[model samples]
Target: MRIAILGAGSIAYGNAALLASLGHEPVLWSPSGRSAGSLANGEPLVAQGAIEGRFRMDVARSIAEAVGSAEVVLFALPANGHRMAMDAAAPHFKPGQVAIISSHTSFSGLYLARAIAERGLDIPVVVWGTTVTAGRRAGDAAVNVSTVRAKVDMATIPVSAAARGLKICQVLFGERFVERADALAISLSNLNPQNHLGIALCNFTRMEHGETWGQNENNTDSVGRLLEALDAERIAIAEAAGYTVRTIREHYHLSFHVEPGPVGEMARELAARGNGGNGPTSTDTRYVLEDAPFGLYPTVLLGRLTGREAKLHQAGIDIFSALYGRDFAGENDLLGPLGFADMTLAQLKALVRDGWPVEKAA
Candidate 1:
C-alpha cells in the first residue's frame, strides 16, 4: 500500500522507513519543508536502532501532492499541528482513502472525520493510543528508532468501521494493533500525557537548566510514586468513563519489553539495561507544549464529563501554565471549536462512536 505521512519528525521518518521495509511505498511531507528538504534533495532517509534501513522516499512539497495518490494518509505530527494539517488536507482527500492519526490526541480523529463528512465523503479515521515507534531525529535525513512497540491500542472513529480500520493498520504496520471499544477508549488509553506530566514536572529544573540526564534513571523511587499517583487519576477517569485503559506499568512492560513492577523500578531496569534514553535538554519540548494542552487537557475534559475530577491532571496543567507563562487550558484549539465545553457526556460519547452531525446517523 502507498502511504502519505504528514510529518517529517522522527516518528514520521521512522514510519516511512518501516513502511519501505515492508515493501510499501511511503511518501513524506514536512509542513515546514525543512526536515524533508535534505531527503528531497536526493539524500536517502536513514533509520537506525530498532528499524535499520537506508531508503529513498518521495518528498511532497504540498499536502495535496503528498496525499494525492496514497491509499493511507497518516498524520504523524505533534498534536498541536493536527488541526492545521487536517484543514490543509481536507479538500484534497479522495474517496476510498483511510486516515490514521498516529497516537491520536484531543479528539482530532473526530475533527478529521467531521471535515471529511462535510465534503460528502466518509473516510475511516484510525486512532492509535500511542505511536508505533519511539525515536528522535538523528540528522536531517536520519532517524534513530529507539524501539518498535510490541502492541499498540487502536480504534476507528465510527464504531462500525473497526474491522476495516484495524485490518488496514495491521496490513501496513503488522499484527501489533489491538482494537479498542471506540475513539474515546483509545483517548483514555494513551498514557503519554499523564506519564510525561510526572516526568516533566519532576524534572523541570533539569530541563530548564539544559542539564543532561537519563530519562529512566531519573525516574527514581520518588518520581515513580508520583507517576503512579498520576496514573491512578487517569485510570479512575477512564473507569468512570466506562473504559478499561492500560495501566502505566503494563505500558512500560509492553512498550519497553521489561518486567512490570513499580514505575520507578521499571525505569531503573530500563536504565540498567542501557535502553533508557536521554531526557530532553531543552524546555521547548512536546512534554509540556503538546502534551499539556493537547493530551492532559483532553483527559481533564473527559474527567469532567465522567464526573471524575482529574485533580492531578488539572494541577499539572495549571502548574505547567504558570511555569511556561502560558494558559495551557486555553491552548487547545480543537475543544473550543468542537464545542467540547458545552457538550454533555452522552452527546460527546455519541459523537465519538458515530461521526459528527449526528442527524446523518439518524
Candidate 2:
C-alpha cells in the first residue's frame, strides 16, 4: 500500500519507518515543508529503538500530491494541527482512500469526517485511541522509535464501516486494532489525558526547570495515587456515558509490555527494564500544551454531557491555564467550529457514530 502521512514530526517519521519495514511505500508531507526537507533531498530516514531501520521515503511538497496516489492517508500530527491538515487534504481525498488519525483527540475525527462529507465523499476515518508508535525525533531525519503499542482501540465513523476500517488498519499496521462501539467510545477510551494530567501536575516544576528526568521514575507513590484518582473520575464519566475504557495500569502494561499492576509500580517496572523514556525537558512540551487543551478539556466536556463531574480534569486545565498564562480550554479550535458546546448528548452521540449531518430520523 502507498500511504500518505501528513506531518513531518517524530510520529510521522516513526510511522514512515514502520511502513517501510512492512514493505509498503510511504510519502510524507510536512505542513511547514521544513521537517521533511532533508528526506525529500534524498536523505534516508533512520529509526532506532523499537523499530530499527534506515528507510527511504518520498516526500510530497503539497497535500494534493501526497494524497493523490495513496491508498491510505494517515494524519500523524498534533491535535492542534488536525483541522489545518484536514482542510488541506479533504478535497483531495477520494472515495477509495481510507484516512487514519494516528491518535484522535478533541473529537477531531468527527471534524474531519464532516469536512469529507461536505464534499460528498464517504472516506472512512479510522480513529485510534492512541498512536501506533510512540517516539521522538533524534535528528533531522532520525527518530527514536519507542514501543509500537501492543493493542490500540479504534473505531470508524458511519458505524457501518467498522469492519472495513479494522481490516485496512491491520493490513497497514498489524493485527493490533480492537474496534469499539463508535467514535464516542473510542474518544472516551483515550487514557492519555487523565494519565498525562497526573504526570504533568506533579512534575510541572521539574518541566519548567528544564531538568532531565525519568518519566516513569518520577511516577512515585504519591503521583501514582493521584493518577489512580484521576483514572477513577475518567472511568466514572465513561460508565455514565455507557462505555468501558481501559484503566491506566492496563494502558501502561499494554503500551510498554509490562505486567498489569499499580500505575506507579508499572512505571517503575518499565524504568527498571530500561523502557521508560525521559520526561519533557521544557515548558513547551506536549505533556501540557497538547494534552491540556485537546486531551484534558474534551474529557471535561464529556463529563458535563454525561452528568459526571471531572473535577480533577477540570482542575488540571485551570491550573495549567494559570501557569501558562493562557486559557487551555479556549484553545481548542475544533470544538467551537463544530458547535460542540451547543450540542445535546443525544445529538453529539449520533454525530460521532453516524458522521456529520445526522440522519433526520436518527
Candidate 3:
C-alpha cells in the first residue's frame, strides 16, 4: 500500500526504512520540511541498526499531497506533534482513510475525532499504545534501525472502529499489532511515559548538569520500587475501569528479552540480551513533556474518575514541574482541547463509552 510517514525524526526515518524495505512506497513529510526535501532529492536514508536498508522517497509539499493516495497514514512523530499533525492532515483525509497514531499517549483519538467532526468528515483513526520498537533515521533516503520492539498494543479512538483498524494494521504491521480493549485502555497500557517519568525524576540533575550523563544505569533498587509503585497505580486505574493492564514483568519481557521480573532485574536482563538498556533517558524525554501531556495527564485524570489515586504518578509530575519551574498540567490543554474540561466525571464516562457529540453542548 502507498503510505506517508508524517515525521522526519529518528522514528520516522527508522519506520520509513522498514516500510520501504517491505515494498511499500512511503512518502516522507515533516513540518520542518528538511527530511522530505532530503528524501525527494534522491538523498540516501541511512540504516544503522537491526534491519538495514536504503532507499529514496517521494516527498510532498503539503499533508494532502503527502497522503494523497495513502490507504494507511502512519504517524511516527512525537506526542507533541500529534494533534497539530492531525489538523494539518485532516484537510487531506478522505473517506475510508485509516490514520494510525503509533505509540500514542494522550487522548489522541478523541482529538482526531474532534478534528474530523469539525471538518464534517468521518475517518477511522487508530491510536497505537506505542510504535513497533524499531528505531531509525534518514541520512540519504535510507534508514537505520538499531532495535525493534517485539509487539505493540493499539486501540481505536471511537472504540467501535477497532476491528477495521486492526485489519489494516495487520496488512502492514503483521503480528506486531495487538488489539487493546479501547483507547482509554491503550492510554493506560502505554509504558513509555511512565518509564521515562521514573528515570527522569531520578536523573533530572544529570540532565541539568550535562548532556553527556546517561541514566540507563540509574534504575536503582529504590528507583525500581518507585517504578513499581507507579505501575501499581496504573494497574489500579485499569482494574477499576474494568481492564487488566500489562504488568511491568510482561512489559519487560516485550521491551527486553526478559520475563516478568522486577524493574531492576529486568534492567539487568535487557543488558544481558544486548539491547544495552539504552532507551530514552534524559530531560528531553517525553516522559515529562509529551507523555505528561498526552500519557500521564490522561492517566491521572482517568484515575481520579476511576476511583484510583496515582500518587507516585502525581508526585513525579509535581517534582518535574517544580524542578523545571513550569506548570506541567497548565502547559497541557489536553482536557480542554478534548472538550472535557467542563464535563463532569459521569459525563466523561459516557463520552468514552459512546462516541462524540454525546450531548447538546450548552
User: Could you give candidate 2's per-residue lDDT for residues 59-138 as a string of tens digits?
Assistant: 99799999998999999999989999999998898889899998999999988998888877778899999989988899
- Pairwise lDDT winner, candidates 1 and 2: 1
- Per-prediction TM-score: 0.98, 0.97, 0.90
> Candidate 2 — which residues are off by over 4 angstroms?
357-362
Superposition error at 3 for model 2 (Å) = 0.6
Evaluate model 2: give its TM-score: 0.97
Error (Å) of candidate 1 at residue 270 is 0.7
- Candidate 1, residue 221: CA error in Å? 1.0
Superior candidate under lDDT, 2 versus 3: 2
TM-score of 1: 0.98
